[model samples]
Target chain A: MQPVIEVKDLCKTYQDGLKALDCITLDVHRGEILALLGPNGAGKTTLISIICGIVSPTSGSVTVDGRDIITDYRFTRQMIGLVPQELTLGTFDLVRNTVCFSRGLFGKRSNPAYVDDLLRDLSLLNKKDQEVRTLSGGMKRRVLIAKALAHEPRVLFLDEPTAGVDVELRKDMWDIVRRLRESGVTIILTTHYIEEAEEIADRVGVINRGRLLLVEEKHMLMRKLGKKRLTVQLKEPIARIPESLSSYDLDLAADGSEIILTYDIRSSRTRITALLQDIKNAGMTLKDLNTSQSSLEEIFVSLVKEEA
Target chain B: MNLEAVKVIYRFEMLRTWNTLMQSVASPVISTSLYFIVFGAAIGSRIQEIDGVSYGAFIVPGLIMLSLLTQSISNASFGIFFPRFTGTIYEVLSAPVSPFEIVLGYVGAAATKSLIIGLIILATAGLFVPLRVEHPLWMMVFLLLTCISFSLFGFIIGIWATNFEKLQLIPLLIITPLVFLGGSFYSISMLPPAWQTVTLFNPVVYLISGFRWSFYGISDVGVGVSVMMIVLFLSACLALVWWMFRTGYRLKQ
Candidate 1:
């Protein structure tokens, strides 16, 4: 089957002479989570804004569920849900009224049971009649989600969903994301937190300065770019490397506490055996040793810096 | 304009405006009462009937239109300005609702408020100075036209305004002065010919004169000219508002 959302050669240039997106091409599957990560000026919001039909694209076009976003905007807009980074809500409105009005805006008839179930799922049933202005920050966030999901769109775009949230609220939002995923909703998340993408995304797309650096499945990207470091703790602090051990090519950390070695994961020869032999020949005893791999965060930083 | 979408937005905006019925009813009634006490009693004492009607009865129509225009401007301008200020407009923009529907909702609500307040102020005037409606249907027609025209005018101000101060600036600096000089309190025939010709430049004179003609069955300006000028102004305001929405001028930017 064709992907749920396809962008051919997407480019967006504002009238103020800002190049927001530069010939970006990507596809999103039906149910997977695609996390788009980038720096501050990285065009993440611009991409989502274009897809949601809010901003006018200078060039290139997007399609949702086989409908062109520009040509068939009304139908395409009906199929997409967007949770903007900004918390925009009618504060004087009641929670239930707010949700119902949102659903009605899309020409949906009044479904009291559907609205009640939505509020109940978001844990807003108790605050249904209370004005939104009286709600806490976390409750307000949930209200935004409820409003976005009111029309039951097939795809949901969350732009920096957890930007100002605390730990507990972040966990709550993540739980909601999981629930929506289970309900067969495709999620596209953009965030400044690399770990958010690393923790929950199936595929990661790193963008910087209006250009996409990489887009790959999480594990495959890790395996392809993963770096391993082996650290060996010495039994006795070595003052210096012996002349006989000079071929080992290792750096003794400051305070002469440990030796560090770096190597690629796909390499057949990590040089561990030769290094162990050289250490034995030099009469240095190894107390403990372990190998570790780099995380998505390290890869993200490297790519962003490379783009810069 | 898609009628269905426009109807949906109309319901939403009208309900939101009606939600403040207390402010809509109370403020205008109180302000019109003050107009009756200060303008009708004090100013009428020095000014005699110039058009074969009591001074108190002559200016009532103009005062009603003044209240209608000012409140309509406030209602529409603030109605659109608040959504932009509080960011709720982003929600409306992202929804399947079109800009035409948004404008219809806002301008319709403003007209609704203006018409309701116009009726209320008229009822309040009956309590202070007795009113005899010479042509009741024409009176209603003028009320409807003034409400809708000024409501559209207010819609234009809303689309152009960027802040709260700008929202208020047009009514305070432009609308109020136009009403004051538009013969709301005095007949334009009382002015010299040069000043009378200059008063013709103010669009609001036609609205007030037309409305005053509805009440007394006579006016300083011809009724045909007054109605024609108001219709032209109404169409121009609507076109400007439509252009603003179509181009997404300050709204989308």
Candidate 2:
């Protein structure tokens, strides 16, 4: 299927000679959540800003649904919603008024019912009449989302949605995101939290120093780059591994009470059964055994580390 | 023409005015009344009529122009600059609305405000002096053109300002001084020929003169010249605004 958002070799350089983005190429498919994982100033926000038309690209092109972002800005912008990382809001405006104003700003006819439903979905219905300044940080963030979604855009770009939110609120935000995806809205979010991406992102893209290090399916990436470790608790304190198990990549535990075997998950032959038989043949009994696969966080750290 | 987008911005600004009734509406009315009390009732009682019009009556157009110019710039500049300051301008910048629509909404609301205040001041002046309009249509033309032109200028100021101090700079330092020295209270004919020649350099002189001519059939410059000058100024402001948007000056980074 054609991607909902297409970015090709996009670049942005500020007047101060600082390069914010360099040769970024990406595609966001419809109704899928693509999480962009990066540290601060990793060009995540800048990339999102360019696609949303908040910042001009120094070079290259972007298209939404096959329409150029610049030449067909009105159509592209109308179809995209951006919830910026900052808590940008008018302090005096009522929550409902701001959302309605956003709808009108997008040239949408007034629809109070639609706005009320959006507010309710964001759990902001109770505070719709309250001034924006009166709400807590989490509520203000929800108001931003409501404003972004007010025009009923087909795609949503959330820049660090849960940066400063508490854990409970963060989970709530993730649920809201899930519901949005279920409604067939394409989502592209930038996040500092690895767990946020792991928990909700269908695909993850790692960026560092203005370059896209890698973009791949979350589970597939873990399976490909991830490693699994098998720990064997010895029945007795063994001095070392037996010569028969020398072919296996093994490490003796610090206290000689356990032995760890590291192996590639992608390898067709794990030789686990042979290793166990050999351990019994060598008279090294096992008290307990467990295995763990590498996590997305570890894969992310190694990717970013390798880039740096 | 994204009329709905324009309406949204215009209505949002108008709502702010309504919410701050005291500062937006009452303050201008009360201040115009005070100007009449001090400059008209108190001072005009001592001076003789000039150009066959009472000192009090002759100053009415100038006073209205004064308020219109300052208020137009203030209203429009603050309308846009406040959003930029608070970071809420992202909504405007990121929206599908065009630059022209944004300017239309903001400048339209600002001019409407100045126009309302100008009319209120006119009515207020009537109570203090016997008002006359030799050319009522021309009077309205001058008032409207001045409001729109100055409001456009104010919109430029809003975009150019980076801080609160810069926001108040042009209105307080430059615009107010020009209005005062532009013969708002005295006719340029009353001055020596050389000073009159120098005073002609002041753009506000043409605006006040044109407006005063509509009221009393007297002016320092031809009514045609006044109209041309204002149109020239308005066109220049429009060009600058268009360039600002095209280049995404400070609005985009």
Q: lDDT (CA) for every model shown? A: 0.84, 0.92
Which docking band does candidate 1 fall into? acceptable
Q: Give per-residue CA lDDT, model 2, range B108-160, as digits (tens).
A: 99999889888988998899889989999999999999999899999999999
TM-score of chain B of each: 0.93, 0.98
Best by lDDT: 2
lDDT tens string, model 1, B1-253? Answer: 3354456566767777668767877888898899888988888778888678888888898889889989989888877788788877766676777666777777887898789889988988888787888888988888888888888888888778988899899899998999999999899999999999999999889888888888888787888998899889888997888788777787663
Scored on chain A only, each candidate's TM-score is 0.94, 0.94
Where is model 1 more than 4 Å wrong at Cα?
A: A234-237, A240-257, A266-269, A286-288, B1-8
Model 1, residue A39: C-alpha shift (Å): 1.7
True contacts kept of each: 0.38, 0.91
The residue-level lDDT of candidate 1 at A68 comes to: 96
Give the 10-residue window scoring lowest on summed lDDT in candidate 1 chain A. Answer: A241-250
Give the C-alpha lDDT of model 2.
0.92
CAPRI grade, predicted model 2:
high
